[model samples]
Target chain A: MAGSSVSWSERAVRLLRRMNSFYSAGSSRCQCWHFSVGGMEVGLVPPAVLKQLRRFPEVFSFKEEKRLELNPGLASYHDRSSAVDRVLQRLREEERFTCLQGWRDEKYEVMPQFSDPPLMCMERAATSLFGVKRYGVHVNGFTRQPDGQLAMWVARRSLSKQTYPGLLDNMVAGGIGSQKGIRDTLIKECAEEASIPECIAAAARPVGTVSYTYEDGEGVFAECQFVFDLEVSSDFSPSVGDGEVHQFYLWPIEKVKDALVTEEFKQNCALVVLDFLIRHSYLHPDTEPNYLELVVGLHRPL
Target chain B: MAGSSVSWSERAVRLLRRMNSFYSAGSSRCQCWHFSVGGMEVGLVPPAVLKQLRRFPEVFSFKEEKRLELNPGLASYHDRSSAVDRVLQRLREEERFTCLQGWRDEKYEVMPQFSDPPLMCMERAATSLFGVKRYGVHVNGFTRQPDGQLAMWVARRSLSKQTYPGLLDNMVAGGIGSQKGIRDTLIKECAEEASIPECIAAAARPVGTVSYTYEDGEGVFAECQFVFDLEVSSDFSPSVGDGEVHQFYLWPIEKVKDALVTEEFKQNCALVVLDFLIRHSYLHPDTEPNYLELVVGLHRPL
Candidate 1:
């Protein structure tokens, strides 16, 4: 299993680099690429920017450049002022360029408006808003109610989200590329997205990382996700971040699965949640539904 | 296991640098500090000569100098030049420097001589004399004897070796940083060290790497060795390189183990050969001989 994870990570890295190269040729300014190095995720800037950076001996040194090249997978950002202007023009047409006010909680904030290409906008949102691309681990904390059913806390995304607006996700899902590892990311995401407290996050135990590729009309995307299992008290209530998350729902596992099958859950929310359940063997053993096969094969015809 | 090897290599590298530093400071000319990059071996020049080298950009580039600071372990040479000169200055002192010469081929014209402080010889002879420190994979080839025993073909080191003169070693072993992986190095090392045909080297299969630490009275060294396994016809006769190697030896497993225990094998030769056997479980399963433990613990008393 460890070998498989390493292989997957290697493949993911290759795919990411290939994607970066493909996208880089089209943009005037190079995009920032992130990759795992020495178990830590770091961002690399484009060669053009790096060349300019070399001139500033005080801020950067050539010796440091040699050190960075030792790990070749790190990505770099290129000059993109013109590209940003073009992206901003597109944003004006969509009326989605309104700046958001900072939220009351210092750590929790709405995505800032960006006048840029959708891809550039997404990159900016991921960096300036979410910080960086990271591996996210999710744990499902649940217990049997008096009625003999398992219940889990789920967070709903705000309708303002550009993608998957008004959809349910894991109680905590964030990138591991952040300063912290999976546990820290989970706590931070849960607190900011669902308002889960430190006490609840502390009880979580990491299961493993679940990886999947997601693509829309925009571009290809990959995520290294982790899941943790936590058992919260029956009466546990989470304070949802109003600016980021809309509401919180505590539902039985069976009901979640039912919603997935009945087309009740939003977008790929059901599939993602179901994937987590099946991976952890939370579902009944005898019920061997081929949901993954169906979902994996489902693709919009080009 | 990989992490442990990295840490061990790092520690060995640190000790080696410290040893070089001590030798460098004691020398007047400071010429004894010669380091190579691309390959991590350091060459110690005599203090008087080393002073000339420090200012000679034609001989050593600035890049090589930078690499020395980054990876001190590659510093293979220490100004043992003065030591060698002192020994050569007196007939009795010359005896202190052990001498061994191995023929490169049947012509016996180009025999390479290795000394304790290695010979400061011509470039071609020097190249073959120096052990290129690099990563390598070890492979074990097998053949059945008429008596129903397994016979292994091992290379005999040249007599003029600084260490392990006239010792038997792996069928193939070479430094890794030479822009060659295990397969490539095996082919080259076998050809030069044992006179094996290129076709046979091509047929060898890499099994694994055997990493070990060696400390002589002078300095500590670490090697990332790759092991390979091959099967040959029983009638095959190894063509020995008289210029580099005196002769070839084929011994059964029992004789090999016996030689290791009796110390009949050359210095440090037993560890390389015996460790390969133990790691691959070639020894009888029922017999619990702690040969590796014994040899590894036999540290030189300060």
Candidate 2:
């Protein structure tokens, strides 16, 4: 939430920024499990899930266990997920959420217990996993002004998109939609969102992630958005590489600040840009009373 | 809360920084309330407290209510609090806990609901109110290097201090004790800790705040430390005026980074300086994969 002193666009951005943050208790009752098809104790499934799981004994198991677990005897992850997918397909029909979107052949790694060995390699469809955590990256494409100032590249998202259509977005953003690498995601997003060549897109750095947990009536949304800052040459011009972006705009830091502090840009973009400003020394702790608060508040403790 | 990459002092600082942030659920089972000596709905007092309040009906009231409350019709704030103070003084005798400190005649405002227009103002002896929220200011003293680099002033608290004695700290830090304003606290602390003259201290700019929430068996601790950046001249040297500080040192950004990454500073001070490093462009997103996460994670949502 934003304070009254914050301008309009900034308020919207602050709220949007809250999408990946921790505010109150999440509404989810389902547990999040690991790649090994083990149950994540943090999540609590509704009572009805017991009856439903009973119907998929081959795919799930509780038989005298502490919590639900994926049948360890499954042949492969593909076999297990496809079985779970079929259940979800039927669930979609039963629940009548035809408008559901974001399903993909690729999967997102959930409950990443380890980064090196990846102790539990849990994978699920990019869609149908709303009640758990997800990951993505948002990049800020910028250039140094002649006076040594910073100017940013902003993308006007395509109106046809489902979320925040026609609103402003980061220069590049893409989900960790599959079992893909962070650098690969940045390169792919850069090429699609801003027409940056793959080689140049690969130069985009992976900074860190911004995380949040929010839940509505449907399910809880816990996400970690990795943030990036890619400095482009002064002569660089961005074209809409994919149809997802309507157009691109190059604006100085002041104009970008106007957009953010006044609520003109899309919501999450506010968080990305605000981070940019603070890290770049544009927003000083002395000048902004909430500076340290925003800095420490953006990430969740591991 | 510090990651494995963070240093020991930095990790300690991060933990101290968590005292006021509401990332996880607070320990209090009771709901928080306001207005006229009433039960603090949130905090769970020991069962023995009922007898204490019963002894101070003139100052405190919980005769029929479940929560704590102040006598609404008290003649003056002092009259009401003095009555309550007697109860606490007597409770100390019963508990037999020695060496309790911070019992100043001053008070701190509890539950600042609005960025502006604070809702309920309850002042209490600073010592006895550790379980509640408190406000303070922390200033980062910096100077420009002749080679276009940034160097900072660091302070070491006196061994005689009650908290984190002999530990590294920001150049200036002081609680918003009594009715002191944020700026006033900064100026006062600067002079005391680093012997920076009042006029020079006044030149400091107000940065944002750093917040966190923490709890132990004793009580829940919520704190907001207003941050500042004061630029000093190269020729200046600090002479400790207050007994609280033992010494001061001037070091460039590189040494400061070593201290932070190696965990040499006090816990909250680590966060303050880490924010400094990122904002000053010492840590860039291109090089640090966790840049956005750190920025967004620093501040808690309102």
Candidate 3:
């Protein structure tokens, strides 16, 4: 539906393939070493990053199994957290990586799974460098027209943003930083990103998640977004808030689908929007030949 | 949350593990040979089934690379289909397998993906013998009470049914026989299984799909289900039709969650219902620790 020569499904698959580059078979990224902490494999370390870790012998270890792990002597959560933070701060001072240039003070929990107690917390911006599974909440805000058609609320990221500046995004999205709760993060993001009140934001239903892992020049990004769908009233309109967004538009679902394959949206945000379309039945199996593929691709192993 | 001793996430993970038994690490099933057709790997063959196929030298070929393929001499789709069906028919007559005893005069398309041109078609009942992928359509019929609570219509399979007899099921479900389209099968199943009218059944929205592969005593079942959600008016109630269902019950969402872990519903059908619960947010990420795992489990690579 989006391309004249290629079908929408092919375009969508291409987008997902881009987001899951690391998982591509036979790629060098597929050979990344497992990153473990406190006996739990929580992240992936590419060969290049592993080479850099060899320098921090006191804090890092390259075991016989080819795994990159923190020093077993750093037992307590506090000790591990500070040990990793020190290495990251020194790397930032040395200007060792371009991703470190966008460093934020935010912290993220490092664990095998979201519910498990974190072995430790690390700077949010550096999580990808270690390939730790990152979590975020994304809200699909939509309204039902009187004719029963659906329209989604789309946001334009601020030009001043560190990543994906000026690109299209979901109406509400924010990382689930350390000590943060999922729903509370969703509600807070809805208010900060789109000026939605707490009562309205509370209505955002936890639909599911969209997960994918890709490696760029910076590091590997393996992320799982807690997806929500909020059916806002037709009379409501969102205004930009927190200066993170430059503009807001209420576009028909068809327009959103067309934009998905054109790179008009931020890469991962497009995936979140694609998930919303599938769940709402805008992309039916009959029209989209890759319906099942698209569904499975959106939730590839994180 | 069904288990008092274990969390809902654990129970849900156990259910998914059961459905995806063949994918478990280091299991004998993980070593099943790739079953190929026309150079494409469309199915999987366990050692036991591979041994049986070797008896029919003219129909199946066991290559030096360990791949089990339909004889390449059967060049065309028609030739390939008839050749495989012949072996299945003989196996049925010889009482070689229990699954073939449920043989219906139905056929299923076999290919690498759902949208691809079929390499061949095989007896629906005997497909699992070669671990070929099978497809079906499942509908989640529900109604919103005046108080805003959601309830679902659940069917009890007729005692005379060949599979999972007298067990709980979705309001409507049916295998996608060759030449039948997904939405058409969904509408047809809705009318036949729940006595829902065409006009109402047409409202069923194709939300997404649930896929899994499991090995059992008979063989391997690799299945993908096109899932639909139909929200009926509160005044409408379903009655049994076609004698496939013995009775129907309108259950609250919570009741359905409880039944999922109890195995009250057929194994695969319960997965479809669990998917509905997740899409509708009856199972929140906060309470369901296995939320991400459950989401990924439902859409495992087929």
Better of 1 and 2 by TM-score: 2
Looking at candidate 2, what is the lDDT of residue A64?
Answer: 45
Please write out the lDDT profile of model 3 over residues A1-302, one tens digit for every residue.
44479877788899998898888875557567888999999998877778778889999998876788899999999999999999999999999888887889999999999989999999988988889999999999899998999999999999999989999999889999999999989989988988999999999999999999988888899999999999999999889889999999999999999887886789899999999999988888977899888898899878
Say which candidate scores most in TM-score.
3
Flag clash pairs in model 3. none
Candidate 3's C-alpha runs over 4 A off are A1-4, B1-4
Q: Rate the local accuracy (lDDT) of all candidates.
A: 0.41, 0.61, 0.89
Point out the higher-scoring one by lDDT: 1 or 2. 2
Compare the candidates by lDDT and give the number of the best one.
3
Candidate 3 chain A has its poorest 10 consecutive residues by lDDT at: A23-32
For candidate 1, lDDT tens digit of each residue in A180-240?
4445667777787667788877876543233433332222333334445677788876767
Candidate 3 displacement at residue B152 in angstroms = 0.7
> Model 1: runs farther than 4 Å from truth?
A1-134, A137-139, A176-180, A261-272, A279-302, B1-302
Go through the candidates in order and give each one's DockQ. 0.01, 0.19, 0.85
TM-score of 3: 0.97
Quote model 1's TM-score: 0.32
User: Residue B77 lDDT in model 1?
Assistant: 32
